[model samples]
Target: MGGKQPVTIMTDQCSAMDKAIREVFPKSRHRLCTWHIGENAIVNIKGVMAKDGFKPRFDYVLKYTDTIAEFQHYWNSLMTDYNCKTHKWIERLYDLKEKWCPAYNKEWFSWGILSSQRSETTNHSISRRLHKTNGLCDFYKCFLDVIDEWRSKENKGDYNSSTGNRYYSCADNMLCFHARNVYTIAIYLIFEQRFIKVIGLRCQRISYEFLVSEYIVGHPTKDFIRHVVKFNEQEMVVDFTCKSYGEIGILCSHILRVFIVHNVEEIPKQYIMKRWTKEAMNTIVEEGEDRDNEEYIGGVEGDGNVSNKYVRDETLLDVIEPSIDTVLPDVVEPIVEKVIPTMIQNPPKRKRKIKNGTEKANERNMRPKGIVEKKRNKLKGWNKRRERHVDNLREETQSTDKCMYHKFTCWWGFGSSNIFKFTIGSICSR
Candidate 1:
């Protein structure tokens, strides 16, 4: 793709693969997969971990802390108390802590994916359509089908983001009205959870200059841990001690609680990260200045408050729609014959002649195939293509109901004009 490379790679430890990554993507950060690391731990040192109550402590060291000091203290304590300092596997994992531990890599945005489990899941998803006996054509078809399915899911996500309402379990009018309309469904849900938690949080001002605030909940729940928030009133910047936003690009409940305490009407523009928004992949097809060539421009990287410019040319509508006055040539159609289905039949027996030239004895050399060799018929007629009935899609050019052309055009953020023209054809294409 262009000159871009992966920001980070999460895979199992292998010397050859590590060397390849270093040579090809020298600037990319490579991390061991968390799942594989834990699996190896369980397989190699389960006795020590289970006997010394090390599993939960080690997991906490990996996931719970966000600072280097805390991670180091906890790790050293676990090793010393459990007598695991001499364990070869534990010592090896400790040396590579910065590669996979959350506390060490909190600054990089991994999109909340900490392991190679997602890669494994994708492999399993496409494994069913693959076989050792599959030909090249079959493999190509399988690849296209998998890609089409992925694009279909992405289109569904876009549709939900465009049409769905921002729903909250609790009544938070400010967030419900704004975040629902601004973010995609998946992202909106995450923000909604934080907003809901902000309702139960009680905030107290600790300092005025730094705008330091302490938030706590009265409930005895396991997640009722107190959080600290620091805000810069003049600069409109907020920081949470949990470091959720820094680590994953999503504002945590603590920051949202501070916002609600300060009576913030809307989310700050700088806090709305473009990578998590619904318009992350939005693009436009624009005409060049020479007016002879067309090019596709990718999504804008402007500030959240800034708007993108688009090219609108209604005269090009004919490129997509057929002209009403267009004349068609008439031709004779060819007749096609349908093939008849054949019935399964048993093979005729063959008799072999003896070497003595006497009566031949009948014998079978081949064994019948096993049931496991038979292919599944479940998907035989799935998503089959058929001839389209054009007449059913044709509508009469007459309108009886009052047209809400104005109401629909002005709906949401769309301007009450056709200045922005978009063709949705690219969404369904891979």
Candidate 2:
């Protein structure tokens, strides 16, 4: 293990561990983790696209030379358009600058931090062990129990999906709600193929009550969702906003995802009562009437019918707004968006064998990829064999058959010696 040291290091930002690594072998490629950048991005921006958009900028920061100038340009652009306040994430952002920017000339880090996600993930696994304990003091004990738990998860080994995405985590929403003097959670709803954004709001942390508002498609979900929470002082603002046909369509995962965040249980009845409103519940009685009646009344109708004034007043309640759950399918789509985009590409065709003549340009291109060259080389070999076979036959019939290879082998030295000996014997006998 000592002799077989690693040539590359892929790890999170750790000062002492990095120092130990350099002392052991100073020359090695050190790259930051990809998943760690995503964690940092989500901590700042708190959504999918902005988090995804950070990768290229972080990568540009990691180049060896001329990287500082390039990274400074990207860093400035990122800081410029970012909607969030700079105070909270300023330290985290600067940590990246220290690690990646060569001109900053910091030696505490040998390489860029690829990601801190793995280390944090390990920590999360450790904390789960404290689930056995009960009560507030157990929380502190559980928190302390996770320091070694990071590596324990990898040792046990199991599957966890949202374990990394952090979309459902407590930090997944915008912090601007606090600054705006309100807190909100909105459901992006689609009803009858129309877009309706539903938002629920709470005044402060400890309050059990929530005020809610609905917003139109023209507004961004973030700002309008904020308006819903902050403005809810009295009655629920149901169907407060509308969308044009262009804005109306199938709901994306983003909208559906928010509905899932705020479960149907937590949703107030006033919010969706317009949709699920029942005739029996809305039945009218005069303010002065006795509230209780025997159920045994037989075949009775209009002994004394209610007045026209009450009937006309009851008509206001007749306008039934369909419940949100019915519309939510329209929002989430009863069927997934299965209309996969397809291009009418002509498939590659099989090549017909050229029986005799030369091939055309179309035939050349249409040659069935790997087989074309293979068949061609085979045909060339067949022709070479045929030519040699014909020449061999011609040479065998002519006097120049010296090149003919007989199956038998005779030693010329032995044959000539026997001939000479026969001649000498004949001469001596004579």
Candidate 3:
């Protein structure tokens, strides 16, 4: 990314990848995939999982804990209850608690991604189109096709975001309106969900510093647990204990409730992530620096060995001039330009050769050749036989029906309704 490191990197349990990330991008926050950790736990602590109430308790400790103290408390309780303190995998997970545990790593921005499943899914899709027999060239072509499909999807998303009409749950809410205007379609929908959820939450002021006030927000009757939200009235900055904004770039319902209580009409600029915005792909170019020119210079100045003027000249020559080898041979060109038109204007007629009587007889006696022709003839003969059999069966059925009708009519009497019914029944039986 042009000498820039990622803010956070998530990968499966791989020691080599962990070490490489630490060495190469020391500043980046490296996290293990929670999914991989869970899978490993299933393999490592199968006995613990088999015990009653262990799985839910383990999940609570892994994901639902709000604070580090709570996480530690519950984790220790779980270990003591399950007698898994001596487990090697559990010990290793505790050692790397900040890497995979959300309670410890909530401060860092991760865009709500807890696993490297996105990359894995893309790899799976590409692998579906590939085989062991595929060469490097075939792999490259498949890769290009996949990339083109991704670009097309991105373009479609962009079009939808730009052209689609905004949906409003509460048309009068300025915050919702502002969010709908600012964020792209997908992000706006997420924000709208959170915004709508604010109605269910109750916010109470807990404490206040110079400009920042903390509030405890939760449902009145439904939920017992409450979340803390710190709001700066002067700067219009809000921070939720859940760190929903940090984790997913979207304000939590607790924070939105706090905003409503504080009479905040619009989301603060800092909280509106640019990546979620409609103009995310648009870059503001500097007044004097042209991006195309810079790219050209960068291409020419690669390794500092090539001259820019020489590169430009070569590029121009390649575009403007055709190679001598690409020109068609003069003799062949004349046949295409001259002979093709003459042939089209005066098409040659196929001449029928006169044959002797013996030759004609031999031709007439000749059997159809080729594997395809023989198969076709065999299929045709089988179909004809089937049709003849069907016709014979239909004739036999008709004769049986006539005989049944005559017998029924004689037994039931000619003009009676019982006769008609018996005849119909006999025909059906036949």
**lDDT (tens digit, per residue) of candidate 2 on 214-242:** 22111221111111111233542222111
lDDT of 2: 0.36
Cα-based lDDT for every prediction: 0.59, 0.36, 0.71
Candidate 1 total steric clashes: 0
Query: Between 1 and 2, whose TM-score is larger?
Result: 1
lDDT of candidate 2 at residue 270, scale 0 to 100: 34
Candidate 1 lDDT tens digits, 405-426: 3322222233212211211111
What does the lDDT read for residue 163 in candidate 2?
19
Superposed Cα deviation of residue 301, candidate 3 (Å): 21
State candidate 2's TM-score.
Answer: 0.22
lDDT of 1 at 39: 85
Instruction: Please give the lDDT score at residue 334 for candidate 2.
Output: 31
What TM-score does each of the candidates earn? 0.62, 0.22, 0.65
Tens digit of per-residue lDDT, candidate 3, span 1-430: 6678988999988999999999999989999888888888889989888888776566656655555654665576568767999988889989998888877777778876778899999998789999999999999999999999999988876877777655455779888888878887767766776777788787767678898998767665433235667888998877676776777888888888888887788889988888999879465555557787776666665577667677788899997677544565755787798888998888764443345533322233354354323433565576569656644533333343334334422532333223334433323333
Worst 10 residues of 2 by lDDT: 179-188
Q: What ordering of candidates by lDDT runs from best to worst?
A: 3, 1, 2
List the candidate 3 regions with Cα displacement exceeding 4 Å: 208-211, 221-224, 284-430
Which ranges of candidate 1 are over 4 A from the true structure?
50-52, 170-172, 200-202, 210-226, 285-430
Best by TM-score: 3
Total backbone clashes of model 3?
A: 0
